[model samples]
Target: MSDDGQDLAEAQRAHWQSAYGDHPGMYGRQPSAPAVHAAAVFRAAGVRDVLELGAGHGRDTLYFAREGFTVQATDFSATGLKQLRAGARQQGVAGRVTTVVHDVRAPLPLPDASVDAVFAHMLLCMALSTEEIHAAVGEVRRVLRSGGIFVYTVRHTGDAHYGAGIPHGDDIFEHGGFAVHFFGRAMVDALADGWRLDEVQPFEEGDLPRRLWRVTQTLPRERA
Candidate 1:
């Protein structure tokens, strides 16, 4: 939204703002493969309520809606969320999708133990600091109902672009006017600290051969 925050997230926010401005619908009108795969997983798990972070352009948001999932989709970029809402309305799934302007670096604007599942794509691998990442994961755990699922993808350290640009921070590199924080096994492990790790698999995307880790986990049905 407003480019007024004094933090690393501000820089990231500005970068995406410019990108979305210059190239609205940059990724086009298609849900990612991970979204399709996640939908299948949700089906088997009987997940109905979902919260999606960084739902850029409503691609995955609309996908989940089409698959009969009720979703609360959030993104920091007004342009992106605006595009998302438009897409949702165009697909006649506006009633199933709720859009919110939110930055995941801060606390989630949701009640505790509310959502049945949380989905995010490439949101965790942005230029977030470790503390921000930890905070985001903590908030996810807090907002998830017992036995809630969390599914996300992050740029992996094995990616082709991992060490190609200016070193900004821990596991982060600035390349092509964008900053990315790449993940290792340990990083993903830490994020699954409070949840049971269900699956972790490697995948690649785009022509850059961007290596990624698709993660799935669940909070125990009965918390101690």
Candidate 2:
């Protein structure tokens, strides 16, 4: 990472820590629509375990646990994970959930082919450069079992805020202390290169009505 990138990452981390500290359960308790959709897909595929990146206070993570999939949720903010664990206990699903403080820029802290499914809601668009995004996806691929499902969402170039914020180059922009890297369609396609791309569906969320793409892909089963 360049000095500027490192600086941005540190600043983002501090910002998230402060944000979660000030507003616990900031994203509300309901599972995101993408999470609900991913749950159904995971069920149909017989997934037993899920790894969620950027789980942010565990709204969707708790929902996945209630649906009976054992979940491992990761986020960069320890404060956010604290809230997630508390929610898990309150929901009586503590046994089904685990929390880790993880930054997606690093290799996932798991053995290869360890998880049956992975979900990341709008995590790929967060202040990450295109190379880092690809590396993060590579880590996802390495940790997923063959035929495992990967469901992720990203704010796209079509979003209203795409170019509205202060530009940090490489498509990253900062607004209200939050930095986002709006993705282009070609970048999404490139990231799915070795995976079996299943779907890329458009969706909107939040009051800003953030435009996003929910991408679902699967690893190919190894040949006998």
Candidate 3:
């Protein structure tokens, strides 16, 4: 990462921490549309455990737990994870949900092929550079079992916010204190190189109605 990238990362982390601290459940207590879709996908694939990246406040994590899948949720903001834990207890699903303060730039704190499925909603589109995004996806791949499913969503280049902010280069733009790396179709295809690219459905979210793609990909099963 360039010096600018490193500085942006630190600033984003601090911004998230403060945001969660001030707003608590800033995103409200509902699972995202992608999470709802992913839960069905995981269930159909017979997934028993799920690892959720960038699971802010864990609305989706708890939903996965309530749906009977054990969940491990991670986010860079400890404050957000704190809220998630409290919500889990309140929902009486604490036994099935675990929270970790993790940055996607680092390796996942799990053994290889340890998780049945992985879900990351709008995480890949953070302030991450293109290389870092690939690395983060690599970490996701490393943690997933063979034939595991990976469902993630990202704001795309067509989003209204894509080119409307302080340009940090590498498709990253900072707006309203949030830095986003809007993804392009080619980058998405490149990331799915070794995996089976299952589906990429366009969707919209929030009042900004952030334009995104809900991508579903799977690994090949291990040979006998």
Candidates' TM-scores? Answer: 0.95, 0.99, 0.99
* Local distance difference test values of all predictions, in order: 0.89, 0.96, 0.94
RMSD in angstroms, candidate 2? 0.5
Poorest lDDT segment (10 consecutive residues) of candidate 1: 1-10
Model 1 lDDT per residue over 60-167, tens place: 999999999999999999999999999989999998999999989778999999998999999999887777788999999999998889999999888988988878
* Model 2, span 99-207: residue lDDT tens: 9999999999999999999999999999888889999999999999989999999999999998987899999999999999999999889999999999999999999
Off by over 4 Å in 1: 1-7
Give the best candidate by lDDT.
2
Q: After superposition, how far is residue 21 of candidate 3 from its true place, in Å?
A: 0.7
Taking the candidates one at a time, how many backbone clashes does each contain? 0, 0, 0
Q: Residues 169-190, candidate 3, lDDT per residue (tens digit)? A: 9899999999999999999999
Candidate 2 has its poorest 10 consecutive residues by lDDT at 160-169
Q: What is the clash tally of candidate 3?
A: 0
Superior by lDDT: candidate 1 or candidate 2: 2
The global Cα lDDT (0 to 1) of model 3 is 0.94
